[model samples]
Target: MTVTYLLVDGENIDATLGTSILGRRPTPEERPRWDRLLSFARDTWGQPANGLFFLNASNGLPMTFVQALRALGYTPVPLSGTEDQKVVDIAIQRTLDAIADRDDDVMLVSHDGDFLESVEGLLDGERRVGLIAFDEFRNTGFTPLKHRGLQFFDLEHDTHAFNSTLPRLRIIPIEDFDPAQFL
Candidate 1:
């Protein structure tokens, strides 16, 4: 199985997972286990992975987060502006469009509702799209989609294990990673 692509919503998923499980900012003590998570991604669909991390370019992202993902073998794609502008969502859609014609599977990492249409389109095009998120509540209108093989990652269940295995993870504080306001 050629695991073609994996899209990650860096801020949304990480922030949610960190707060709910870590109870604070993520520590460097969890790097290796996190690496194992990436390893899970690699092994789940088989090798030769194309990982893309989606972040908001306008609201800005932390360089450390970008670098961390890059180190994990993911290409970071930052979309400019807000969700209302839908730039991040649109970028992911375009990427999906590029591969929709091919027989490839995509792993989407987000709880954002905006992806419903895009995910539907991918599924309609015969692409196996897997939704990855840490959200435990399943009745958020996306349950139907989840039933269609939407993968859920319980940070609560996995974080401690992740932390125990992976320590000394490189970190960039949010305050330091914020972008400068030119306006």
Candidate 2:
């Protein structure tokens, strides 16, 4: 049977949402619905999806969020390290390396470019690889992966993982602009 490893980098997603997209902390209505993301992953490949949420718990474990992740069928991978180390990224990168040896597919839910190398390694005809993020905020470095067959799905649009539409700034097509409506 086919299976997909849905790896989530919560920090990267949250940073992009608050800093690049929203310009402020996301309200409850704007927060992503984790369950919806998991469902989307399962539906994408029509197979069972194992969601793994990575967090930098060097400060302390957020029990509430960890519990929520468990309730939603995601394994919470909290990591710790030295002050300068990026624990979550390290763990996710290592996990990706390990997944490269397996036949199961991968869906990474982060806009960070740090995983580009690992992602590229997984495109060797052994399994399907996918990236999930907001189109406007995703790193341009990942663009080339599309030509190599790495599918991309928008977290909000494709996954519908939020209750309300998020306010994001994206370039609009000149043809899409209606001056009369604004006037």
Taken over the whole model, the C-alpha lDDT of each candidate is 0.62, 0.90
Give a tens-digit lDDT track for model 1, residues 51-117: 7877787866779978877786778887787557867777877777776777777876677776676
lDDT of 2 at 103: 89
Tens-place lDDT digits, model 2, residues 113-179: 9999999999997688999999887889999989888998888878999888677665556976767
Candidate 1 deviant stretches above 4 angstroms: 18-34, 59-61, 82-86, 124-126, 137-139, 146-161, 164-183
In order of appearance, the predictions have TM-scores of 0.65, 0.92
For model 2, the superposed segments whose C-alpha errors exceed 4 Å read: 171-183
What local lDDT score does residue 83 receive in model 1, on the 0 to 100 scale?
Answer: 57
User: Which residue window of length 10 is worst by lDDT in model 1?
Assistant: 163-172
Maximum-lDDT candidate = 2
Clashing pairs in 1: 28-168, 28-169, 29-167, 29-168, 32-166, 33-166, 57-79
The per-residue C-alpha lDDT of model 1 at residue 166 equals 22
